[model samples]
Target chain A: MSAMNKQILLKSRPNGEPTAANFDLVETPVPTPGAGQFLVKVIYMSLDPYMRGRMGAEKSYAATADLGAPMVGGGVGVVEESNNDQFKVGDYVMCGTGWQSYCLSDGTGVMKLDPKQAPISTGVGVLGMPGLTAYYGLLEIGKPKAGETVVVAAASGAVGSVVGQIAKIKGCRAVGIAGSPDKCAFVVEELGFDVCLNYKDADFPEQLAKACPDGIDVYFENVGGKVFEAVLPLFNDDARMPLCGLISQYNMTELPKGTNMLPALMRAMLTHRILIQGFIISYHFNHLPAFLKDVSGWIKSGQLKYREDIVEGIENAPEAFMGLLKGKNFGKLLVRVADDPTRN
Target chain B: MSAMNKQILLKSRPNGEPTAANFDLVETPVPTPGAGQFLVKVIYMSLDPYMRGRMGAEKSYAATADLGAPMVGGGVGVVEESNNDQFKVGDYVMCGTGWQSYCLSDGTGVMKLDPKQAPISTGVGVLGMPGLTAYYGLLEIGKPKAGETVVVAAASGAVGSVVGQIAKIKGCRAVGIAGSPDKCAFVVEELGFDVCLNYKDADFPEQLAKACPDGIDVYFENVGGKVFEAVLPLFNDDARMPLCGLISQYNMTELPKGTNMLPALMRAMLTHRILIQGFIISYHFNHLPAFLKDVSGWIKSGQLKYREDIVEGIENAPEAFMGLLKGKNFGKLLVRVADDPTRN
Candidate 1:
């Protein structure tokens, strides 16, 4: 076991797009396992858009990660030492231990991972927070019935990919909105979505309308900007929207300029009796067991699939994460912080 | 009875503010009741801002009144003749009988009025749709627990008045928003609202913030536009919004100019886990019996109060209705189409 650990800390709040200067990498002593605590050597770190919200001082669903603190994130790790009865040395687990080589946990939020069933890295992606987010948001709020059209933005990414696939499994037509043709193809051809539209296309709205002939019954709102504008007119009566995230406007310093269509939005809601709800997965933590059960079964039966874009080194994590904001990553973005002992 | 009858018909679709030229008064032979049908002499016609939506060709909850068709509206009337076993002559009932001196009904959607309990005009105002709207909207969607702050726009109008009173009954601090100082005064002094702020006040937002120190938990959205803009910033985490109507923007021919704040609205909903639902009373008609029992008890116990603006004569119904859209009526606007036979 290494005596030294490399940690990334938040230096200052970013005004708009985050820079490498905003994060400080420092060598520190590896944390010791306390009573009922386990020391983990992180193998894979999840880089999600939600972390952007944590970086800002603005109020969000999750509390802002304080400056000068190790930037908070979800990661899969191998237990190096254990004082906890539930975990033992070399047991693979998923936990929010931030951007660090080693971390300490007391088995509170940490969950055991089965490398035999699926890749250990998936414990932070497909069978984890992003996957759970899509499952609950779509099933609980979106409530897409059979034959209904379900639309999701950022469709090639972690949450959106799962949302699209789940919609398909529920017997609904899944429409994906991605930034490029490659991402669109990945969503449609790889993830089994019925259709995928490039949001950057000049005729994106027209394409969306054509794709959703029955109109959109459920809109899994992950990216809110131009994609939202395109989806707005296609929303049918009694449309249900589960607002999971808004990656498009996360870096926005000022309110975007556009047609003030709030009245229209309100009218659509009132006339059509639409239900639009926003949620965070933490609020529905009690349903985690059920989520894992259903998701695991689907993955095992080949009814659901997931993709991962793994960056090899922790030093490249900030750049990969930044690229994720710009819709560059084609799948769930993760950093390989250390070699996987379970795989070896 | 005279064979001749006066009826108001849709003449033309208005551009913005409806004019008298948009409505036409026609003389027609009164139609006789058929088997299982009854004749009604409309005594009081309800004037509501929602009627504006019906005048346009645009799709809404209610179907648009076609040109040359008799203008549709809710009214309380005495059954002048009956072939239906359910109704008898001289029985006061509430029905959607259009703007006319007489109407023929096949007994569907007509409710018998208890003249001994309250004024017959209340069948078209506080104790009827508006009252039931406030009752169900607040209790079901708003779900204001004891001590929660509930804010309502158009506070002295039919629905808003009942909403504030109901919130007060539920041990909540009821804050009212009206257009005029006099209306605001009536809401606070007469209706017993904790605070009343005029929407016309230059410092209205500040006043609303000051009035709701704990923040608004339930916002009954009836009058949209600037009132909604003001309430947006003060909405607390997990706030419930029952969108009943958007009267302020009903007359809009063009989209309003401002920052597209829907992303912010979505972000707010996400950050707060707020539930915003739009509903119509017809959707929850089965709950009416329970609502009537609860609301009637509140009114009789002096815990609920209502106001009515009664305009005399059916000929003035058009002007009275026009005033409703302008927020000119101080209370529930009702046109006394005929003499209250029971009162006489």
Candidate 2:
């Protein structure tokens, strides 16, 4: 048990888009687990758009990550040592372990995972936080009725992919909005969206309008800049918008200028009786059992599919996270932090 | 059947705020009611914020007022002659007659009003459309739980007054936002709001922040320019916004350009799991009978109070409507088109 723990700590808050200089890589001694606690050697870490808010000083639902502290993130790992009754030394667990090689947990927020049932890394990706996010956000907030139109931005990403697939399962016409033709093709062909339109296209708005003839009934909002601008006019009467994330504007220092469309947005809402709601998965954990039962069944039946973009080393986490903001990742963004002895 | 009929028609569409040039008064001989139709002499015409949207060519929940036709409105009138079996000459009824001195009804959308139970004018005001708007908007959209702080703008007006009273009935702390000290005092003292603040005051935002220490759980939005700006930061997590109207910004030809706050609004919705829904009363008409029963009971029990700003003549309707937009009316704005023979 002489292994040293390497972690990434925030050196300072980013002015706008974060840079490597804003983060510091440091090595420290692995922490010991106290009574009723377990120690985990990190295997895979989940990178999400919500982490951007944690980097800012603004008051949000979740607390901002403190300056000079290890940046917090969800991770899937194996217990190296255990003093807890519910876990053993070899048990795989999912916990919030920050960007680090190892973490010590007291079994509060951590959940045990069975690697044999699904891919072990998926405990931090599709079968975990991001999957649950898409599940609750769509079912509870979006509530897409059969034969209705459901739209998702960043459609090839982890959450959006799950959202579009779930909408398809519910007999909806799933329309995906992505950044590139490849992502659009992936969303339509691989992910089973009824239509996929690249946001980068010069005629994206017109294309989206043509794609949704009946107008959008439910919009699973993830990327929220120009994509949202394009989608606004196409929203139908009584449209439901589940505001899950805003990856497009995460790095913005000042609010976007040039288009004051708030009044138009308000007018649309008033005229059409639209409902727009915002949610985080943690706050809606009460719906987890139903989510797991429904999503797991969908996966086993091959009705819902997911993909992962795995970066091989813990040191590459910072770069992978930065690339995520630019929509460079094709699927659930994960970092393979350590060797899985059980897999071999 | 030889009575002369006076009617107001739409002469032109308004550019921003409407003026006298937009309306034309025409006189014609009153025609006899056809089979299954009844004739009524218009008594009271209700002037509401929703009428403004109808004036514009833009699509709203209701059809836009057609050019060179009678300006659409809701009115309470006494049956002067009857060809329909459902109504007699002496019966009082409420109908969508627009701005006119007489009307013919097929008794489809019109409701029979009992002058014995309450004033017939209540059919168009507190015990009617405005009352239903308050009940459904607060209960259905706002969902004000007991002990939560509920805020309503345009506090002494028809819809806001009912909203504040209903919040009190639901055991929530009711805060009212108005334009003047008189209206503020009326909202607090007469309407039974827990606290009332004048939106015109320089320290209005600060005072609002101080008044709602628990933060705003529900905002019954009617005035949406500066009042919404002030209410934004005060909103608590999971706040419910029943966006009933946006009277303050209704006259703007273009969106206000100084600060674009849509992203911030979207962020607040996402981070806090807030629900913002826009609604018109007609959409919730199915719940009207139940709402009427409950609201009528509250009014009878003295648990709910209402006010009306009645102008004496039909010609003054335009001036009164303009004043209603400027917040000059103390309560529900109604124009007395003809004398109530039942009251005499």
Candidate 3:
């Protein structure tokens, strides 16, 4: 292994949309692991929309990433050296590797992964945080029932894809909304969604209304700008929404200007008995065991599918994440920091 | 018995706040009950905030009150005549009596009330709809835990009074908000709330903050304008909101002009994992039996107390209802259409 570890750090907070100039790519001497610690050589680092919130100095659900420090994230990697009895050399694991090629861990949240069981990259993709997020948010909060209609936006993305497939597994009519016709087709055809609508179309709202002939029962709220505005009016009485993320609004510098519509929104919610619950997966880790088992089984049985859009280097993370905010990435956006030994 | 049946009929739908000019008082020839029917002489008519929603021709959770039809409401009255086996002469019962001196019923939704057991007027107040609303919206939706803080608006009124008392019963710190100092005192002294803030005061928000040292865990949303604006900022992580009514917005002619705060609100909801569930009490009839049992027990044990604001005469119901929308009534607003024989 090289003596230098390449890491991406947050240089400054963005006023609105993030730019590459706001991040710093640096190479630092790899630190040796201390007593009861291990070193993991990162293979894949996850780039999620949630990271944008952490970049800001404001108080947030997740801890803010300190400026000039490694941007916080999770990754799948192989243990290169270990002093801890639980983790051994040559063993693959998933831990908080951040936006770095090499990281030191004391195994607090480290989970040993059997690369032979599934593709190693999946530890940072479908079988990891995103998958668990989809599982808990959809089943626990969304509570989709049989014959009910479940709608999710960013349908081709990691969380939305899993949410829709799980809706189908639960006997619901799963409807997806994506930015492009291609992504929409992939969601409907490959992922087995009942229908997928391209939200970019001029008559997208009308199309959504037509797609959901029966009003939406469970709306997995992922991208919440125009998509939510469209779904708000079409909600069935007693609708459940698991508010996971608002990707469309994350880059906003300030609130939009218009007629204050909260009263109207509250009215709609009350009249329909809609339940909107915001959840962070970390707080709901108690659901991890069931989520892993069910999601793994679904993947094996062809009831679920995942797609990855892997960017090549850690230095490219800032651009890839910026693209993610603009709906530029096709699927689960990941930064491949090093070669996966199991892949070859 | 009077030879004529007097009823208040909807003359027209009001644009915002209801007016006396929108209703007509008419006398119809007293109709004799046909087979399987009974005649009821309304004694205590319930005047509730939810009535305003039905008065509109727009789509709402409630059925629209047709022009020239008697405004819909529940009432406690005596069965004057009966062709139905379920009812007999001089038997007090609670049923849909509308705004009328006399009503004909076929026994559906009619609950026989015993004047000997409790005050018959309670069928529309504490032991009835408003009481059940507080019980269900608090225990079921709010789910307050011991030592947690629960906040409610319109604290001296029907639902809010019950909500705070129930929070106390569950070992929670109850904080209340009311429009007047007298109402605030009544909420604190009479209803056993830990604290009550008069919202009309200039430093009301600061007073609310001081009242709740711990952040709010459950917010029983009743009035939604300024009161809601005050409560929204103090919600703790994992706060649960039971949206029972938005009485403040009912008389709004149009949405207020300002910067759209929905994004900021959504961010707050997400960061705190808040659960805002809007509900209409009518659909949850399954919870009624449990509500009646618990609330009755609490009232009998002196753990819960109730007050009624009674306005005499059926002709005054329109004005009473309008006053209710403006928060003019101090307690469970009710129109006493005739003498409550049970009272004397």
Candidate 4:
């Protein structure tokens, strides 16, 4: 084990689009655990679009990341040292370890993980917040009935991939929208989505309309820009939209220059009786147990599939995170901060 | 009752805003009730925002109004002659009688009303569809908890008045927005809202924010142009919005010119985890019994109040309906097609 801990700190708020200069990587001597505290060696750190919202001083559903502090995020780690009675050394756990190699925990929200059941990295991926988010949002808000057409954006990403798989399991036609042709292929061939459209295509809206002949009943909204505009007109009466993220608009520092389409959207909503709900997964932790059981069962039965885009080292997190905003990562983007002992 | 049936029919779809040229008033000899049908002398006809959507060729939640048919609307009336077993002679009933002095009905979607319990005009106003809309949308979608701030637009209108009153009954701080000072006064003093703001005021947005100091927990959206713009920034975390009507945008022929604020609204929704849902009351008639019981009790106990803007004669129906879109009506806009026998 390394004697020194490497931490990525939020140096400044991003100006429009984020750059590597917004974060600072610093090293400090690893500290010993206090009386009831434990030290966790972070194996895999999550890089999500939501973290971008946290970088701004504006109040989000979750608290903003403080400048000069470790960038706020969740990670799966190993309890290397423990004085706490509940958590012990060698126990694998999931906690908000942020962008760091190691973090001290008193076990406020730490969940003990079993490496024998699945890959330890999945504790931060399919078996973690992203999977739970997709499960709750799709079932609770989207309410995709059997034979309904369920459309989800960011098709090959963490949450959307699970959303489409869950839709298929629930006996619905899952339509996916992705940035590239490769991701589109992955969503269809690998993830079992009924149809996957490349949103980058010039005739993407036309393709989307052709793909959804019955109209979209459930739209799992993650990317909200031109993508949302395309999905807007094709909504069936009583359409349900479970909105969790707007990756396309995250870097936008200004409102788009165009005729205000707010009224048009509102009119369509009324015409179709559409229901749009935004949610942050942190507020829904109570749903985690049910999600874990259902998702774990599905994963075990091969009804659900997940992919991890693993980037190596804490130093690469900034560039990878920036790339994530532009849809560069192919799947659940995770930074492998340290060697996974469970893998050996 | 009149010997001749006087009807106002839709002549043409409005280009931008509607005018008298859009409708035609025609007189025909009163037709006899056929087998299993009854003749109704229409007394009060409802002029609602939803009817505007029906006038357009573009599909709405409900079907578009036929070009030469009597303008589609609900009305309270008396059964003058009856061959139907269910509807007796001299019984007051509510049905889609449209803008006509007399009509023949086969008893579908008709609800009998008793003037002894309350005014029969309320069958199309406070005790009918408008009341039920407010009840279900507020309780089911808004889900106003005790001490929550509930803001409703078109405060003096049928649906909005009931929304504010129900919000108060649920122990919420009810804030209302209306078009004029008198309407605002009626909303606060007569309808018992905590505060009411005139949307026409230059500082109305500021006033709304000040009124909802704790932030709006539930916003009952009926007037969805400028009123919605004001309510957008003041939403609390996990705010609920039940969107039933968008009166301000109903007559819009083209998109408004400005920087598109859709992204800003989406961002706010995500930041606060807001839920915005649109509903058509027709789909929710199954909940009519519960809504009728609760709202009737509230009205009987004086906890809920309602006002009607009655324009006499079928000739004035087009003008009154035109005035409604401009917020010229003081309360629930109703056109009196025939004299009410119950009132006499």
In TM-score terms, candidate 1 sits at 0.97
Best by DockQ: 4
Clashing pairs in 2: B73-B98
* Each model's total of backbone clashes: 0, 1, 0, 0
How close is every model to the real structure, measured as TM-score? 0.97, 0.98, 0.98, 0.98
Give the per-residue lDDT digits (tens) of candidate 3, residues A35-97.
Answer: 999999999999999998999988788899999999999999999999999999999998999
- Cα lDDT of model 1 by residue, A98-188, tens digit: 9988999999889999889888988889899999999999999998899999999889899999999999999999999898989888888
Evaluated on chain B only, what are the TM-scores of all the candidate structures, in order? 0.98, 0.98, 0.98, 0.98
What candidate 1 gets wrong by more than 4 Å, as runs, is A1-3, B1-3
Q: Encode model 4's per-residue lDDT on A227-318: one tens digit a residue.
A: 99999999999999999999999888888887887998898888889999999888888999899899999999999999999999999999
Candidate 2 or 3, higher lDDT? 3
Task: Give lDDT tens digits, candidate 4, residues B1-344.
Answer: 65998988999999879999999999988889999999999889888878888888988888888999988989989999999999999999999998888889999999999899999999999999999999999999999999999999998998999999999999999999988889888888888999999889999999998999999999999888888998999999999999999988888889998889898888888888999999988999999999888988988898988999999878998998889999899988898877787786
Segments in model 3 whose C-alpha atoms lie over 4 Å from true places: none
- Specify the highest-TM-score model's number: 4
**Residue-level lDDT tens digits of model 2 in B1-344:** 66678888888888899898988888888868999998989999999988888888977778999999988999999888899989999889999988998999989889989988889999999878988999999999898899999999999999999999999999999999998899999898888899899998899899999999989999999888888889988889999999989998778888877667788787778788889999988877998889889998998999999998899888788778878878889989999999977676
Cα DockQ of the candidate 1 complex: 0.79
Candidate 3: which pairs clash?
A: none
When sorted by lDDT, best at the front, the candidate numbers are: 4, 3, 1, 2
Best by lDDT: 4
| Candidate 2, superposed: residue stretches over 4 Å from native | A341-344
- Over B98-172, each residue of candidate 1 has an lDDT whose tens digit, in order, gives 988899999889999999987898888877898888989999999999999999999999999999998998899
